[model samples]
Target: MTELSRRELVTFLASLGIALPLGRAAFAQGTGGGGDPAPGAVAADAAAGTLIRFKEPVPYSFERLVEETREAAAKPYDPVDVRFADTLERIDFDQHNRIKYRADETLDLNDGKAPIRFFYLGRYFKLPVGINVVDGDTSRQLIFDPKLFQIPADSPATELPDDIGFAGFRILEPNSERDWIAFLGAAYFRTSGELDQFGLSARALAIDVAMPTPEEFPRFTDFYVGPSAVGGRVKIACRMDSPRIAGVLEMDVKKDGPIVMEIRSRYFAREAIGRVGIAPLTSMFWYSETDRGRRVDWRPEVHDSDGLAVVTETGERLWRPLNNPANVMTSTFGTGSPRGFGLLQRDRNFSNYEDDGVFYEKRASVWIEPKGGWPKGSVQLVEIPTDDEIHDNIVCYFLSEKPVAKGDAIAYDYRLTWAKDQPDRGRVGEVVATRIGRGGIPGQPRPPGVVKFAVDFDGGMVASLPRDAEGVEAVASASRGELGKVDAYSVKVDTAWRVTFDLKATGPEPVELRLYLKRGDETLTETWSYQFLPLAQTG
Candidate 1:
């Protein structure tokens, strides 16, 4: 993605932060996404959250069973045979999100910390993650209760056969009455970004995210949920399966303090897996401060993640601003035993988003701080070109030194911070804003052959320097376009310094853009790398 599209992607993805909480009774009454289950399937006499009696209940040891997942990966991947399409395929968005398990009928065994609320089947979400509860040595099925939910008068959901199950389930607040996390939609899940607002999604694993072949979305085939040790975090074990790989995951989740999840996975590759992305975060970058100039709309910015922040093993911090180009783009920051990397929504100002419906400022900037050292690797970011804002185009993940193939096992441990700002790792200047227009001096006809750009740098070294500080200069280069006179000047009104330059494009093609601030060659600010969009528009 280029600078122009980055601005637009920022504007679009930021708007998707509207996935708010479903109220108590409000959820049960919701008929959105998908409708209710067939009434006939839900026996007329059955009440909500009832004990589901069916196949002989088989009890299993939680710890021993989790380890079994590791053992299961050693064998040839056996495809899961459960199918539930008739009840899922016909459903749409509203019906899918509407499949709210009744709040009153929440599964409460006094075993798991909280009862589970199941999401209904619908269009976007059809396959449900199997839900189960466990105690010291016993496991039980969480019965599906229809009376637990309130249905709309015209709702088309009919309670179906008792044997029918759910897609996946969401874990509500552990200590508080709030809903902090959820396990829904694919092998995807996420906590509210730094601001407690759910935005980007973290998948258990990505088979081939940016590949041409249809991206195969694996499901958490089953969940072994159990109670936490007295006053401790809950332990939910997961078993994942796809045509390509199979593995297990143990999520040790806490509530108020920093929410950290430890993930250990192995791939029993059906064949050579294409691209494996660990701790992959999925988000959208439509347009923002730097790329807004290319937009023809009313909004100022849109995006869930503005840039990709990577910390190398040597402790070097690098920032790569996101983009939405006319074509797919892939960039990698070389590093070793990466300390951390993630898609961040660093810009936190309401003015950035004029749309009152979706508050972008409150969106969380998730920082993936690895708990243990990840072997030599690079933080790879893939940006896919997108015209509209609905599709997520930004993907960030760490590639380990180990090449991915069949029978390969990978264990990754990372701490997911749900706070607002990045941790106090180091001091560095931040890219405040980026803008573009006709390249030339004021009062002069716009330079015929050049595209002008203005980049703002604030905070860190730049903000502390004396007003008349010398040595500070702008370091910039173009991947293809020719660069002209470049100069740096303070904005006067703010602590920001604006770097202006003209790029002479050879033709209609887009160009890769890069810029940064330095003092006597000592780098003081983040290197601002961007993609300059070249769209023909009437002035």
Candidate 2:
């Protein structure tokens, strides 16, 4: 797909009206205590009209849902029957935003403590999904009615049928006006995170991303929402379906200080799959401090995440700074039952971003911790080139060692934490900044093919070292280049240690570089692994 089309698809899927800055009072009504009503009951607001209507209750459980999904996989994939494609398309962005969910119509869960709101199907979101409210062992599907929304008189949505299903839903924080988590378009979902600003997103699964063939986007066809066993948390169970796969996913989401979600997914493949990405994360990485030459906007930096941090099964820490390469790039790190991994926006300085509108500094970093023993696999990182921050060009996920075949049943369980920083903070120094420039002495002529790299390290042991500390050395290596002028020393301005090196590429191929710091026999910093594109030498 073209870059613009890809950006549109991902951007719209990640967020629509869910992240808009609407007033809290608009969604703060109907907060009184009330239990879930019986089947066929109508949640109505006398002044605002009917809010929600439910169909007959159905027997529901996680196990039964899994069995149902497996049976669906055995049959041919069934596509969603969009009710009014033409009319819905007329409800463009402006018109769609004008149609709002009335505040009094909010669906109350957990004894009216948790408020839920629904999104109306519009131009981009035509394929609708079933939404159900679960109470104890039974679930009642919400019947779609036009009365739930306040549609503009000129909007084309009024022409659509009343049975046109919902586009997605969002969960509002109790006693607050803000929404913490939202699921919309495809199987994509995201939370406001610890910063209360939506940034990166997580998907149910990713199939053959960055492969030669077109990527398959398995969408959530149904969502069952209920109260979690853990008080003050919400449990969401989703049924996902695609041409080649069908799966069931359950997430117990808690929004306290940070958003924590325990996710369990089970998949039954209908066809042989080349690549299956479990716990896939999607974020935008257009440009950062490492490659400032690619900046197109006035902002100092524009990206949701700046690097990929991995904790290998062997307890080694690796940090790979993100890049916006000239071409699509895939980097694979062999991780056998990894301890943890995440895409981090480590830079918290507001001055670094300068843009107060989006507050890039406040974007939350998501960390994934595997629950059970995951099979031997590799954490694959795919970086797609983009000129703007609209596209979500960075995707990373865990790829299984064993290929998936038809009728293969696979399962994965993990915990997702949307926090201010990564959860696993080791005693080793962490990479703080990465910069590249000309490779010669300041007063000397710059080399044509050589590039200079300056990486700063701080935290852990590096922060404790004295300025006059001795015996600390920089360890550097390249896969296909000559490394020289290596130097590591403490900077007078900050507690961080600075490491600089010159790398001369011997060929046109990209070079993989590894660097770290050590004192005597002790390793002092996490390994900084980088992929240097030959074209980036100009920067």
Candidate 3:
């Protein structure tokens, strides 16, 4: 998709109250089986192989898909056209929810080890993706069948043609109604995380996100789903294409408390990508305890994630608390072969949120770990302002230091872990919470041109330290500010150490603050980094 068209498409989807921005397509004419075939009957002509039919399964492999993507990228881009007739056009949220896929019609793989279901085409998701079932070295494309869905006879979706095709697909838990993994719009896919609730989404490829120009969204045109080499995991090969880029992604996904995806991807740039993001993650962060004054919600907190956690190449763990800034903010942490990074929902106390409907505490943290020789880059974070929780206002990804030129062959290997907490590689204390307020001593007028931060650190060695532990000290610094009243004290409530400090800003420019707890020069916690935008400047 071209940059302008992609922006328009995503804007349209957001108008309909979707979670993440994804491209959509206009209706186009296509041909498929006219009627619903028998349960195991072929639905396409055997002579034509652009699309597959049950008549015969053809040979397929990930390498073939990679070659196909490479060749496609070498040529000009072609966008798909999609259309939905009468009832389907009126498939609003309620009506769409009513049109459910039949469990019996699910595509089974490895003798029912994996059961896949299709999502019906709707107003928000108009593009159709090819879905194929792979077995051994061969694969068969599943034809669209109205009978696959159980739609209300009175629903407008019934007016759609027999070959309306599928919007996306999802993988269901064995013997359960809940789905653990799903691939929806564009190149977006997500799992139900460690807590069994959907939160953030991971994209196959990201081009020029948070740049001056509009972001390019690569769409997955086709997906080959089959059993994995290992038991209990499903393998999906995706063909991604866009105006600026084309790529192939092979993902082996499995759910065992924490949902894990072993992703192998290769891309060919049709044009020089200004800024490409690897293992890009999209999420929402409206407001939390750190900026409670800015929040106008009844709930105590509202967000899918609260901070961006990173383990740098030098073994330094940094936790940068996320913010819904007044304007777009992009922070880059340079590293070489970084260990991992993620958008984390660290505060898991239900009492802190009191959101029973959309259990924010149950949302999962998504961490990206590079598997092979990762190129040098910076873990970049983009925080966009949002008034409500529906919009995904936060994005994090690894950006290579060098730009991707046209015809460049790009490859990356990474594993995504969607869990409740990131692995404690440092085994040191970590930031549990961050709160900000006006700076001043109690019972006195709040000081001007200053901000107070109360950061709580818990877990690992810090939590084990006694209340009267000696040698423990708070270390704080700022890029462009004067630090004042910095001290670490034990809190009674959560067995965590609270570091209270005040920052006297030198100017209206944003201040980069860093702090941590230590005992006689021995580091005791992960570094806490934050960008403090002066109130006067933010307004």
Candidate 4:
């Protein structure tokens, strides 16, 4: 997605009722009072402390949270009250940006090793969510106080009441000005990753995304945060509620090189859902090298991720390049308890992007590694039409084979890795780049209704093959077109191999194309799967 304007961002946040607070301040020397005070200590400070306040202690645990969620699903959905809606509406983008969370009031965790801060409610984020600090078996709800934020004198936020709730919270990089992980707006949360650049975002669950009906965004109404049992990790238990579903998510988040999150979620459906997307990843894909014809910027390429990479349960690897379709398109790949899948930014060269301001090349590639045994499902990819990068038009998620029904209780466990690369790509030739153009040989009259595809593969056994490798061939197939002029050879400068083929479309419908390099009967590279839009292909 391209960079969103402040106004556009506000609108987007307003639609999702989620907003990522802006601004960062230098880390203060002292703790946000004191590190995780003993059980009732924080509650005791409710009457004494002015900067931070907490409600009476309450017994809490992940299991209790799940049970509470199940109970919530059995009842009618209750929406969070928007306190001082008029005042919040007055706090526009400019005024909201001026309102900053007080760094001195940060809640210290792990002896101040990880500083936690709360987000202020604004125009886009009028609804408040419960923020609690967990201490052992007890938790205290953080009381909202106007003093927690440094608001401009002229800001409408000044009109908000002292009991007004928070929009979200973020975990700062220990003693650093920047934050590593942030949870805001619905069930959306993301990390800066190892490169310190935030790109794609992952949602706890997605209902009816890209479906005929409007999508349902489950909001994390409350969060219980504390130190994790695992060393150097923070545990966050969230209570998510929606009109159709109620759920609990327990995340063990740790930042070791690549930010890793062990996520366990349980959902109770209040009503039947047309589609349920688990561990859904949302990103932007406007234009890339392969689809340069749709470029609207001066940069060579613009996208958060380049392709959707999936490893099937049977060990088949597939790479599908992202697209900016003319219309909303959904692709489904039957992946029965797939090993892993993710939207990756494989092209890390800065030269390819030429975008220093946002550093598109440094965007993190988020991967979902399923834990335990997932039921038979398909990895669904939804590509919506987007002219600019500001819009996140790409969504990838796991869709269970069975349809979700009312009273259906489901659970999913997965590990999320936000890093520069996927966790396990396996020992195989991977697709480095995919380019398309007019079909046929250079300097010759190109065939009508035909498109040329050039796929480059690097590493794996393909790298070791000779330039004139005997028996090496490009295996190609198309769903609704004829494939010809297939060729495969090693590049002169490097061990990278290149596969070229031409596809003649017989109809206007999109064609599913697949290609891979093979030496005799042995597969030499990961399968390159693509949706060839005949009508959208530019000559």
TM-score for all models, in order of appearance: 0.82, 0.92, 0.89, 0.92
Writing each residue's lDDT as its tens digit, candidate 4 over 1-539 gives 12323423532463363543443321121112223332222132245565777899999999999988898899988876777888888876666655666666778887887798877776766788999999999999998877666666666766677788888888887776667777777888877787887777888898898888888888889999999988788999888999999999999988889999899999999989999999999888878889877776899998889999999989999999998888899999998999999999999999999976678898899999999989999999999887666677888999999999999999999999999988897778999999998898889887787788899998878777877788888888988868889988887768898888888877678899899988888999999999988667752
What is the per-residue lDDT of model 1 for residues 268-299, given as tens digits with 9 covering 90 to 100?
Answer: 55556778777778887778876655675578
lDDT of 2 by residue, 66-171 (tens): 9999999999887767777899878755556556665667888997667888888877678888999998899999998776776656668768877888888887
State the TM-score for model 3.
Answer: 0.89
Model 2: lowest-lDDT 10 consecutive positions: 24-33
lDDT of 1 at 189: 70
| Candidate 3 per-residue C-alpha lDDT over 1-539 given as tens digits, one digit per residue, 9 for 90 to 100 | 00112322333245234543332432101111112332433233335433323435788999988897888888998877767544555776545655666555566676777667778887667778888888889988888876666666676766778788888888767665566777777888877788877667788877787778978778888899998989988899998889988999999987788888899999999998899999998888888898877868888898888999999888899999988888888999887778899999999999989976557898889999888778888899998877777677788899888789989999999889999999555679999989988788999988887788999999898879998898899989999878998888999776799999898886567789999999986899999999887852335
- For candidate 2, report its TM-score: 0.92
Runs of candidate 2 exceeding 4 Å displacement: 1-10, 13-50
Alpha-carbon deviation at 291 in model 3, angstroms? 0.9
Winner by lDDT: 2
Q: What's the distance in Å from true for residue 431, model 1?
A: 1.3
Q: Report how far residue 395 has shifted in candidate 3, in Å.
A: 0.4
